[model samples]
Target chain A: MPDKRCTEDEVVAELADGMTIGIGGWGSRRKPMSLVRAVARSSLRDLEVVSYGGPDVGLLCATGKVRRVVYAFCSLDSIALEPHFRRARQDGTVETFELDEGMMLLGLQAAAWRVPFLPTRVGLGSDVLEHQRDRIRTVRSPYDDGEELVAVPALPLDVALVHLHRADAAGNGQYLNVDPYFDDLFCRAAARTFLSVERVCPTEELASNGPLQSMLISRLWVDGVVEAPFGAHFTECVPDYPRDEEFQRAYAAAARDDEAWAAWRARYLDCGGHDAYRDAAGLR
Target chain B: MSGPAASVGPGPATRADHCVVALAECFRGDGEILANPIGTVPMIAGRLARASFEPDLVMTDGEARLVAGPVPVGVEAPDVIVEAWNPYRTMFDVVWSGRRHVVMGASQLDPFGNHNFAFIGDRRRPRAQLLGFRGAPGNTVNHATTYWVPDHSPRVFVPAVDVVCGIGTDRARALGPSGRFFELRAVVTNLGVLDTSGPDGRLRLRAVHPGVAPEDVQAATGFLLPMVDDLEVTRPPSAAERVLLARIDPLGLREREVRTS
Candidate 1:
């Protein structure tokens, strides 16, 4: 087995400027914040981020790292609108490819399965056809000549980042929570996969303790595994911690003001990695 | 009816409570359906509805688990009864099967009940990127859908949406039989409740909030709303509904979203 265990820096080093990155998490839940922070701090620019967005999108947008964002939603769950993403959009800082949640999934699915395009009826009458007309096309079904479907093209990604509850040294991920989001699809779709977990346990522990169905990602797919305890900070990694609402609120408030965000970023995110963030935020 | 006056309408509850009650009322007749409320206020309404009269309404724990009882919003409850495991994929199954009823937020809602929370300005190069059309298209086309707008203004209640996330009466009609399952149920705003009625099936004044007048709703709306001859005042929560809402939302977080002023 290839030694998948590596440092967070090694994972970030794999990324380059202007790459199409698929981030796994549903909005503010189980986001790979460690990798996200690494990217934010890096010199990487003009990156295209694909995510069921949360703070990761906001952070990248706020830092001017992202050239385009493809998302179903960008709200911070309870906070409603992700302030940074909203501001970025309103200010015309970043471009976006808006897809219906299902269509977004289909796009990932097409890439994962190595298909050119997948047909769907989701965005038939809606303006998604109007907006993403370049990427999507109206096609008549072969089975029934008159039956029309939307051909959603594949969103081939350069890298995929995901945070899970736990993983083994070989990178077999275990999500003890309710949903796995689209981590598996993301891993399959991306050229490279970086798996960050709250803890890295022995392979035997993963077999004995983890739920059979929640074991979404196989080690064969994971290129690197970085042990990032509390990695999905501010976002909920269920069975670990609830979402840090106070910090999320503070982040939102700070996002409204450049000075406040600067001070907040300097004190927390700019300090160091996850441990430094923890210490600075008085987390532990 | 000699009872505690505080238990029912005209009670000490804020406008938020009344707004929640109105939103909950939208799901009153909807029995044994999946209540997928995307935002905080809508989630409150769904949970409140489930806890009260609409007992059979199923709710996701905002993660993936289907809960047997109402789990408080944003609070991590320790002993939540996990009735079933509802993964993200299974959610799509529920959506496709016409089994779910979602109460979604709207950045812009038109006279035909079309909603947009996706993008603003030109389609090719949008001036602003809102949420990508997240499940709104499928949800509106698949099953029943209701909208909740915290701020009722001419901006939200627009003449035409910049982007159509959810199909309205006009588009549904254009689709003919393919749009058979489309049910744009109601629009619950801070000011009042709007629904489709009359011969044309356009947005109509269902009921105005207690302090809100018909003229107030008309003035706030960018498009002309067909008002009912006998416009009823939105009902305040009954004693039972109030008690249920209190249990679901003990922190009174609903008030913060729906302003009394």
Candidate 2:
């Protein structure tokens, strides 16, 4: 069986400065942390990160690698707000393109389907349209004289990084968690996709497992595959492992305190590869 | 179960318990709707509602999985049977279809139920940037929305929300048929429960929590709350309901959020 398996660093090497990157996962769940760590370690600058918003957003913001962020919401889930992201917003360190969650999905969907825009009823009467006037447009519905809807434009990405439960070396991926999230759309919307999975089993093993619905991203959409067990640590990746709560607490706590963050990063993030960090953090 | 401090009576119940019970009551007649409780306290209420009377109500484990039983907050909940995969995208499908009933926090809420969580002050250069209109805008127009305010203060129950995230009664009425399904169901706070059941569709004092005076609620609210001649006290959790609350929240996280003080 032909394998496209490379490394986390090789996945990061495909990315460049000032490119739009989409990250897969709901807030704080199934994030490609190993790849994100790789990006953070590299001196990539001015990257525009598109995510449902999790620690990926927080890490990029803390590292000052992000020039702009296009997101619906950014949080540490249980923590509600990502402290670093919040600090970035308060200080105006990064430009933001905040959309309604639905609109954000539509933007990705539009890109995935090769459409210029997608009509939505989401931000019709809210301040979202007021704030994001440059990006969103309103057009009269073709069916009726006075009916109107918001037109959310496509958010094409230079690269998309995703983490899933299992995949084959061919880049065929499956999500064991309840929701596949927008991982499929993220892959389709991007020019290239790099997937990091917990395990790379035989193709037949994945095929025999069960429901076809669980197989989210097909090999065609993926440009590369890396097997990174515990890739989404500190974030929940169900059926494999829950989030590392103790580590998450430390991360969030460090994010709030400058000196604490410096020391913590020195130990985990600044050490070496994901292995060194995982070892220091005592991750199995 | 071991605590002699815990009791069955409404008087003995803590303020957080009252809030959990009151928040849970919002789903009483909802009948098989998606109960999306956003925050910690609200999650407790949603799960308590499911495990108790509203058994048919669908609930996510708050991360992703739609579980058969209400999993305790912040726990892995291993071996729990997953009913369905209601991910972020599918969640929007439920929202757009007006099937989800959400209980989320509000930075400010007007008398007509216009809520804000976006920002304060001017739109362009906000004095403070809160969570940008995440889903509140779509949520308000699409389905039943109940708000929770842990602390009742004039700043929160504002005369006018600087930014409109959720569709208030005033705005919904102006939209006519398009906003027909919009329902600002209830406003549950630490103080009491409020609703827009009055003739004018302004927030009315539905029920006060035990030991909370009607005047205290009024003083805290920025707008006038139409009071009934005889205000009812929010019902406390039953003995069985308390048992389920304990099971649903083994760590007593709800108590920390609601606060007995």
Candidate 3:
């Protein structure tokens, strides 16, 4: 087995323009902010970002890196709406392929299963079918029942970026939290998967960290494992720390104006690298 | 008929209390099913229902576990008695099985109970971009769904929603057998309780809260709301219900969600 250890820069280096990148985590919880910031800082353009979005979508949209967004909802959980993503949507800055949350799940499942599409009754009569008429299609069941279902197309991604609590040198990842929110599906659905963890422990210690079920991402699915401490900063990583509400508030406040955003971008996102970002963000 | 006995320990029931009771009553006969409630008032209501009358109702710790008892509001990682582990992935299994009853918030709801939390104004360029069509589409179609509107104004109770996230009665009926499980159970707002039991499955005013007039509800609504013949006033929380409400929401978070004035 190969040691899949890499850097955030190396993960970002593999990404190309116009690629569909799936981001793991839901709402404002346990996002790969380090690699997201790296993507934002890089010159990546015309990217189609897929996510159960939080500030990852908002930050990318604010940095003008995203050309399209494939999402169910972009929320800041506690704040209801993500300010930057709201602004982007209101401004029509990025084309959106919004589907039902279940539909998005099915799409990822379809890709993981190597199927063209998965049929479901989630978006049948809703505007989800009407809005994504070109992309999402309906298929009648071939069996005797003959029920019409929405065929959620496979969302095959070029790359997947996820943040787990711990991993090994061989790229086996584990989540210490209660909910492993679609991280494994995102990894399995993508061609390449990069995991950023709080710590890179030995394979023996990794197995002893938590229950067997906590081992979400296996070594076979992962391409790289980057050990970035506080990698999911500002987002809650449970057992480690809660979401920095004050920092998130500041981030939301900055989205009010371009001047405020510019100042914020310079102070946090544009500050050299991950180590500097932690220093600027005052992450302890 | 007179209202229920004056609320015990918590003083007389305020508008928020009435709203919570009304919201809780939505799950009255919902025996032994997942009572997934969004927002502050609905969360309190869900717990209130479970703690008081509907003990069989299943609740979550707002994360993963299917908690045996009702967890209090705003308390992160409290000592909970776990029933089962339900992650986001497993939630869909429950959703698809029609075993869940969700009380969600609505940004805009039409006459036929079509909900829109996706965006306001045009889809091409929205005037206000809210949380996109999240689980609403799936939730409404999958199982019995209800809405809790803190503010009952024309802005929220609209004639036609900009984007239909939750399939309404009209659309659901059109889908034939596919939309079999679709049920717009109830709509509990600050002012009153409504149900889609009117002619042609239109929204009908089921009851009004104490002091609020039927005309007031009609005036606030963008569309004409058909009134039920036996128009009843929404009952205030009973003594036992109030006691449960206090335990479920000790910090008075429900008061902040709705207008007490």
Candidate 4:
């Protein structure tokens, strides 16, 4: 078990170019923005980012750090299209992939389960098949007597960047809300995993009161843990804290105005590290 | 079904059955429901209600637990596969894949119409792994695919996808587009409906929702959007539709607020 604390850079240092990286967040909620920025600063190129939905992936796309993306849901739930994704599609800058929310989980589950793939009727007859032709193969099962099944191949990753509510030096992380299914399995299935949390404490503390005690992150599966607060601000995690609706409104208002957007990016995103920007913005 | 989607409304000149299905509605369909995109369920319910199809739709969760009628039956934990003859089978197989039009959502939709709901990216550390590209690839080739964007923004739409979850027009063409099933049928939103025609398909505005202007739809979109001669407002829920929606969803979905305005 790791007994020492690593800096943010140390946590993300292992990433290399053309790496397939899974990010943390759900519709901007519970996302680890600190880690996303850390990846942004890194020399990694052609990073393949997979996420459920949020601005973190958008930020990667916006910065041109992302070469391609695998997503189930993107956008802040249709408030508007993500700018980078839209521009890329219109401009053909990056490659994109789409999936349904549950199917994403099952694909991961196939990897976690150590199965080559799981056959499902999820996309039995849609456009999803044409693109996933490589990943999905149709094999006739003898048991089913010539029944055609869509098999999704095993998807293993190099690293998983998971953000959480709390963790310790040993990497036992806890979530505040949104039980956040699949993230744990995702981390466990990866070769290396980095965790960003709001606090790192004794695992016992998390076990003491949290509704979910059995789902704590084990030490062996996590390599690093960085504490992050208000990490999912523009993309918010509820109850512990609400999404910054005001920020969303501001972003929405400014995103459409090029000058306003440029100014906003310069003020917040241009400065580099979260601390400098946070300090400048009067945050922690 | 052949005429414009707008002229087929409920007043007098319309057949009652046509009046119901004519208005685009979500038929709570749970048999093949994918859990993420997290909003498709409510969306379907909302659209169905808006169309005034007040029939107690079949559900995996709800009031009577039957299709289009009320009973005191609580939802039992029965295996969906075990109950292959489920009332919802028709919803996913026939309705979404049938000749009817549908507006579903996805995490990633690719050019080939192959979608992924399997893993977000690494699958190892998915922030939120939705139901693996559930029925997107299959459904697209079967129905009029109108992708809904509860979260439409730049980062989500990409040039080349890390994983192909569903096939798009380009991919459909690459796969040799003999039929219209393989391409994205449309894109529905709080703002409007996006559809297209011809080889170099441009996402066009088919219809705008109530309170949402044509310009608002234009303001929200980020692609080469096409506008129809005139757009119609998405129909809202009626009294009977609301009652059925309530009966089927009860508290399970009623209180959930819409992410979009």
lDDT of 4 by residue, B1-261 (tens): 221222224532112212222223433232233211124344434335432433322332211122322321223334322222332223343533454444555555332333344445443344434444545555555554556554444334444455555556655554442334554645544455556552366456666655567776555544335577766655554545544434433333322323334
| Candidate 2 backbone collisions, by pair | none
Off by over 4 Å in 1: A269-284, B1-21, B38-41, B51-53, B70-79, B119-130, B209-212, B236-239, B249-261
Predicted model with the maximum lDDT: 3
A1-284 in candidate 4: lDDT tens per residue? 56645666787777888988887666656777877877776777898887765777767776678887777656664354454445444455567565555456656667778887776545545435545575567655677355555675656677888877778778887776634645786786677888887777876787764766534677778887776666555666655576676766665555555587677677777677767766655665
- Per prediction, fnat is 0.65, 0.49, 0.84, 0.24
lDDT of 3 by residue, B15-103 (tens): 98999889888899999999999888899899989988899999887878899776777655467889999999999999988999999
Better of 3 and 4 by lDDT: 3
For model 2, residues A35-55, the per-residue Cα lDDT tens digits are 998999998999999999989
> Which candidate would rank higher by TM-score, 1 or 4?
1
- Tell me which of candidates 2 and 4 scores higher on DockQ: 2
Q: Against the hidden reference, what TM-scores do the models get?
A: 0.89, 0.89, 0.97, 0.60
DockQ computed for model 2 against the true two-chain complex using alpha carbons? 0.50
- Clash count for each candidate, listed in order shown: 0, 0, 0, 90
> Native-vs-model 2 lDDT?
0.85
